[model samples]
Target: MKTLGRVLTAMITPFHADGSVDFDGAVALANHLLDNGSDGIVVCGTTGESPTIANEDKLTLFRRIVDVCGDKGSIIANTGSNDTLRSVEFTKQAAATGVDAVMAVVPYYNKPNQKGLYAHFKAIAEATTLPIIVYNVPGRTGGKIIPATIEQLHRDFPNIAAVKEASGDVNVASEIYRRIPTDFMIYSGDDGLTLPILAVGGCGIISVAAHVVGKDLNEMIQAFERGEVTKAREIHARLLPIFDAMFVTTNPIPVKYAVRRLGLPAGPFHLPMCEPSEEEAAVIDAALKMIK
Candidate 1:
C-alpha cells in the first residue's frame, strides 16, 4: 500500500479518433505526470470520463497506468458508480488489477441519505482490501457526505483511508479531520482549493489542473510543507487562472482540448461531453498561454 502524501494527478483520459480507449496515449500521459513529479495518478476518475469508459477499458487502462508508473508512485482507481454492487465489483476488479487505492464517490443523481450513504460505502469497504478514498463531490454527485456521518464511517471502518474533500466545504473537512484519526488522509477534490484545504490540514489534492500543469501543482504542496506559505500562495494565485479554466466547462472538455492544443495526440471529446464552442476553446487557449 502506497502512503499517498502530496498532489495526486486525477488523470484526463485520452481518446482516439474512433472513440476507442487510447491505451498507448493513456500510458504516455501517466508517464508524463510521474516524470513531471505528480505524487500519484487517479485514473478513470471524473476527469477521465469514467461514465463513458467501459469495464474492460478501465481494466486495460488501470493495468497500463500501473505498468507505466512502475512503483515510482501510486494509483487511485476511481470506482465511484451509482450502483453500489457494481461499484464494489469494480473496486474489486481494480484491486485485483493491483491499484494502490480505490476512490469511490457518493451515489450520484440518485442522491442517497446518510443511512443509504453508509450502506453504500460500508458494502464497498467490505468488498475490497484496496484502501478506500471516499469521494464527496456533491456538486457532481447530487448529495453530500455529511461530516458527522464521515466521522462515524472513519470510526467504524479501518480501510476507509482517505476523503477527497471536493464538497467545497473546508469546515466540513476540518471538522471531520479533527474527529478522525491522523492516519486517514484528506485530498482536496477541487484543484483550486488545494492551498485552502491544505491550510485547513488537507494532505493533497486529487487535481484536475494537474492534467496540464503537473509539477507546479506538486510545488504548491511542497512549498506549504516546507513552511513557505507565502511561496505556496504565490504559486497558487499564479496558477489560479489555469485552475479556473479547468472548470470553465464540464472538466475534461477544456483539459483535453488544451492537451490536444499542446500537440499531444488528445482526441475528440466523447458525446454528452461534446466539443466546446469556438469561444470556449479560445478561452482555453488563452488560459493555456497564460500558464506558458
Candidate 2:
C-alpha cells in the first residue's frame, strides 16, 4: 500500500462559543494547516475531540474538508471506536463521505488482545474499500497491536496501509520497522519522537504541534530525507518545547487554546475538557513564541 504525505495534522475540532461544532472554523483550519505546511489532515482523531463529537457531525466535517481540499491532500477520517460493529458501520459511512481514507484505532477500554485486535481491524477493512490506517496509541487505547499481528493484517489485507504509532516506545516502533514489509508505513503519533522514529526507519509523523509549527515539522522531515541529519535534529530540538506544551493539559485543551491565542477561529473546548490553567496557558504562550 502507498503512503499519505509525511506530515499529517491530527487536527483539533474548532467549536462555537456555545459548544456547537464550528463548521466554518473547521474548514478554515483545514485550509490553514495545508497552506502552512501539513501535507494531509486527519479529522476527528484524538486531537479533534472525537470522544465528544457526534457521528453525524463527523460525516459533516469530513464532507466540508474533502470539499475544500479536493485532491490537494489526503483528508482522512477517524472512524474507530471501542465497538467493532460500530467501527465497521462508521468506516463505511465515512468512506461514503469521500474521505481519502479512514483510521480505526486500537479499541480503547475494552482492551482487546492481539487476536481480537487483528479481528477488529480486519472486520473494518473488509467492510470498506477505503485505505485503513490502524492507530496504536497505547496511551489512549489500552491495547498494543504487536508487530506480528500488524504484519498478519497487512499480509491478509492490501487495504491495511499504515499504523499511527503512539506507544511512546521507540523499541516497539523499531521492532515494527524491522518486521513489517518495507512498503508498509509506520508514522510517529507523537511529535517529539518524529526525528527519532525517522532515524529508526519510521516514515513520518501524524502530529498535533503541526497545527502551529507545521512548516518547521515538514522542513525537518525534508531535511532528514535530504541526509541533513544535523539540521533535522536542530529542527526537532527547536520544536521540543511546543510539543511538550500542547500536551501540558490533556490534548485539545492546550491546542485549542493555542489556536485561539493565535487568533485562529478555534473557539473553545467542550465539556469534560476545559481551558488550560493560568500556568499551563503561560507555558503554551511561551512555546508559541519560540516558533514566532
Choose the strongest candidate by TM-score.
2
**Per-model lDDT:** 0.85, 0.90
On residues 1-292, what C-alpha lDDT tens digit does candidate 2 reach at each position? Answer: 3579899999999989888999999999999999998989999988899999999999999999999885778899999999999999999999998999899899999998888998999899999988889999888777788988988998899789889999998987898888884878889999999999988878889999999999999999999999999999999898889999998988888988999989988888878888889999999999988877
TM-score of 2: 0.98
- Tens-digit lDDT track of model 1 for 1-292: 2357587888888888899989999888888887886888899888888899899999999988887685878888998799999998888888988889899999999989999999999999999877889999889878988888888787788798899998887887788778873877988989888899888768888887887888898888889989999999999999998988877888888888888888765787778888888888888898998867
Best by lDDT: 2
TM values, all candidates: 0.96, 0.98
Candidate 1 Cα misplacement greater than 4 A, ranges: none
Q: Clashes in model 1: which pairs?
A: none
User: What 10-residue stretch in candidate 1 is worst by lDDT?
Assistant: 1-10
